[model samples]
Structure formats: structure tokens, C-alpha cells
Target: MADRKFALGTFNAGIAPFPGIVIDDTVYDARQVVPHLTVATLLADWEASLPALTAAAARPVGGGISLSGLRVLPPVTPPGQLFAAGANYRQHVIQMAVAHKLGAEGADPEQLAAAAAAEIDERKKHGEPYVWSGIPSSISGAYDDVILPGGWDDHDWELELGVVIGRRARHVPVADALDYVAGYTICNDLTTRSLVPRKDIPMMGTDWMRAKNFPTFFPTGPFLVPATFVPDPLNLRIQLRLNGETMQDSNTGDMIFGPAELISYISRFAELRPGDMVITGSPPGNGSHWGRYLQPGDVMECEIDGLGVQRTRCIAEAD
Candidate 1:
């Protein structure tokens, strides 16, 4: 019982349990504790330390801090580094191209009307690629609030399936790439649409870091379901909601660039270490499509088939 693979975290009532390294009653953050173990020293080792982790975790943690009373922290506090794919979905790419074209020319009344009609017609066709960078310092654990940054009047939610690396993969072959994955987790790549314009080239251009990377921008976790649990990461279902209203609804099968290809491509440039996370892009149904965006006090929820659902609320920036 002390040397077996087990998922840790406070599981009771409404509190979302983050899969972590449970050492007695004190659950050291999973990402933090993994570094203490040298083998693989990355997400791929999510299962390698089973024997030692189970034994250490079984030891009774002194003090009266029961599991239920603990507030879950981000599973992997520092993921070496974080990067995200943009417009990886076939449908999302098409939508982005149309948006960019419409935004390019539509200043006049005649142009605005034509652009509107073109946009509607384009919706029937596929879109193109659009990229943006996410803020890594703003990452948070599941069940945490995503505080919308100041100057951002319209925030948005993007439901994405995050990939956790399992080993030191550098230019690994796509066929064997999936083997390097440790597991999967849910990530809400919250964005400020009004701030991150899809325009081509403006006088000042665009800065996605400020628009997408605010504190708590990447709300992740609930659990890192082992890869064994997800034989085919591309077949799972993904869904998102705002205050219970379904926003993003789709499946991994819709991804144009699959996980293996993405991992291999990224590793070509950087030596992806343990705990490094890659948000594999989001599906359609973003607030930008609608006239409104995330308002303070709105609750956002993201769910994947194997990975447990992640729920967070929006808050105003502090004065």
C-alpha cells in the first residue's frame, strides 16, 4: 500500500482536488516536489517515483491540518517554462483569417457593411493562423480566481488541454513523441480580447503578453491524468462555460497540429524539461465572437474528458 501509484489532493464536497504529491497530511506541491526527485526530473516521471512517493506520502503528517482543510496550490508551481500554440484548431484558424481580413479594411460605412457581409460568408469557410504569447508568471492552480488586468474591459476564456512533458526530448520523432508525455491537465488560457487585437500591422502593433498574460491568466489543474489513462489524447472531448453558459465546445480530434507534432516541433528549438507545460491551443466560441467579454464576478469552467474540470471566477484588478 505504501509503494503504489496514487493520486493525491483534498477531495471533498465542492473543493476541487489538485493532483499532488501527498506527504502525509502536508501535500508538497507536485511540481515543487518532483524536482526533489532526480530521476527524469520532469513530468514523464509522474509515475517513476511511485514507490518512494507512496511510502513518503503515507507517513502520518503531524499537526491537526487535515487534508480537507488545505487549500490546493498549483500542481506544478514552476514549469521550467511555459509556451502555448496558437490557432491549432482547424476551425479557429479559419475564423482568425476572416477576422484579420475584416479588421484590415472596414473604417467607412460602405466598407463596414461589406466587411460585415464578408465576415458572415467567411464564417462558412475555414480560417487561418494567428499567434499570441501568454504570461507565465500569472499561472495559478485550479479553483483559483483569474483576476482580469486593469485597462482590460473585455476579458475572454479559452479552454485548452495542456500537455506535461515526461522526459528530455530534443528533436524527438513524431511517431515516438507521445511516449515523452507524462500526462494531461486542463488549462484555461484566459485572454483580454479587446487588448489582443488580430490586426495585421498597426502603428503600435500588438502586445499579447499584456493582453493574455496577467496574474492567474493560466488557471490549470484538478489533476494530471497519466498518459496511460489517455491512450489517444486527440480523441478526448473539451468544453468550457461562463456562468454556466456553454462557450467553447469541441474535441481534441479537431486539432490541426496534433500533440506529437507540436512536442517534436517545440523540442526542436528548446530542450523541454520536466514540468514544462505547452497549452496546445483552444477551440472556437470565444467572447470575441460575441459582443461582450468576461465581466467581474463571472465564473469560468473548463473541462476535458480525462482531466477533471477546472473552475475559477473573474475579479477586478486591485487599485
Candidate 2:
């Protein structure tokens, strides 16, 4: 209904979080249009709320708040379930393989890259995505501070395109998977690389709970841009900067498993509900590759096309 696109976010004006819509640069409290609408409720009935949200965006603002200096919460607090795709980016997987010596040391970079690309193609043809679940408590707002866990020295950043599920999805086909997506957002899948593979449980392998589920480990959302606005999820640019230095930069096209395939694959085993998030894997250029880990007082700014930017400050956890 509004002339421009719409995005959803939660803002605190000193009290509880309230649903707000971002049009241009200002945030209009959506309660002025629909008093009962919250981020969770909007996702639960996303399609039904669009009309009212659009109308609300066009209405006159009597006391709309400026976004500057305001506290912005995660668009969807305590999302239904958070699913993260691992090793889903072609270049990132190649980088990891080479870094971990999965490929021969003497092999040429071009040859290795070719081999990696071939491997990814084969996997997409016959393999399924690697999906891992994260605790809801790990989520924090896009602008919130990230706490570096005590005794951990390998904290890393993995900027990703976060897909928000709008409808209940089970056994969805790849062709129709995007239909279930409510919108898209930005998510920083922060990791404690040292705690990933457990030595105590060698056979069990990765311990995501300990490595990825710390409080504020997942910093997400400046706003949730509707799916319709994002014409092609695979063509977006994804980048992250650490204290003004660009650390991770790549395109969504590098993904081994695109958003549609990922949604379809995950739905086979788990029912994706509204407000649930599927974080498409991050691109190449992680701290491990650069030999630089996150430090206290470091700021991370991540952005994707259409989706708003997320600026997060890192701090050390209290001992």
C-alpha cells in the first residue's frame, strides 16, 4: 500500500519492545495502525498482516520516532527455531578444506579451486544440506553487544543471509520452497572455533551447543525485508567489516545450497513454522582463514542487498 518497500523491526522507547516499520529512514510505530500486532504475531499470520502494514506505512505520523540512538531489538525475538546451514558456500568450503589440509598441499590453487567447485556440484546433485539447530536464547539484536565467552580465544564471525519462514512448511519441494519464506534478514553466526570439535567425544564430532549457543552469539536483524522485495536471493552481495576493515566479502551466488534447496531439504525432517529462521551458510573469509579472531571492543558491520545492515559491538564476557 505504501509507495516504497516495507521492513519490520522492534524498537524500545524505554519500555517493552514494540513492532515498528521502517520506511525510508524513519521508524513508525505500527501499533498506531494495529495496536495488537507484534513481530511474532506478524510472522504467525504474515500474509494477513501485509495489507494493514502497508496501509499503516502510508498513514500520517503524529509522533513517529527517529531511528537514531534508539534501541533496536531482533526483528523476531526468540524465533520458533533457528537452523543454520554449514559448509553450504562453495568458496567457503574450499577455503576450509584447504585450511584443514583436506586437499593436497602441493596442489595448485587453480586446480584445487576447480576440484572444490566440482565437488560442490556433485554434492548439490546428490547430497543434502548440512543443517544445525541453535538455541533461541543465543539471539540478540543487530546492534546489541556480543559477549566473547571466557577462556575462549577463537571467536569468529560468519555473516549470512537469514531466511525467515512465514508459513508452516513440511516436505516442501525445491521449486515451491520460497513460497514459505516470510522475509529475509541479516544474521551474524558468531562461532567459538576452538570448542567446535569435542576431544572427549571424538566420534560425535562438532559440538555446536557449546561452540555456537552462547548468549548473544547470534546477532540478527536491523529489519526483516519481505520476500517479494528480494527478487533473487541468490544474487545478493554479502559482506562483513570488522572495525571498518572488510574481513568477509562474497556473493550469495557462491552458495552450494541455495535458499530454496535448503528450505526444501530441512522441511523433510523438521516442520518450519512462522518466525523460524534458516541462516544460509556464510561465504569465504572467516577469522580462521585470516588468522584473526574477534577481540573485545571490536565492532562488526554486516550487510546484504535489500536487507538492512547490522552493526554489532563485541565485548568480553564477565568472568
For model 2 the local lDDT of residue 43 reads: 81
Query: Candidate 2 — which residues are off by over 4 angstroms?
Result: 1-3, 35-37, 104-112
Candidate 1 Cα misplacement greater than 4 A, ranges: 1-47, 50-68, 97-133, 197-206
lDDT of each: 0.68, 0.89
Clashes of each: 7, 0
Q: What RMSD does model 1 have?
A: 6.7
Model 2, span 32-129: residue lDDT tens: 77655578877888887777787777674657778984799999864679999999899898897777656667877766777777888899898889
Tens digit of per-residue lDDT, candidate 1, span 143-226: 988887777587878889988776788988879988888778888888877666546557667767767787888888866655
| C-alpha lDDT of residue 55 in model 2 | 71
Predicted structure with the largest lDDT when compared to the true one = 2
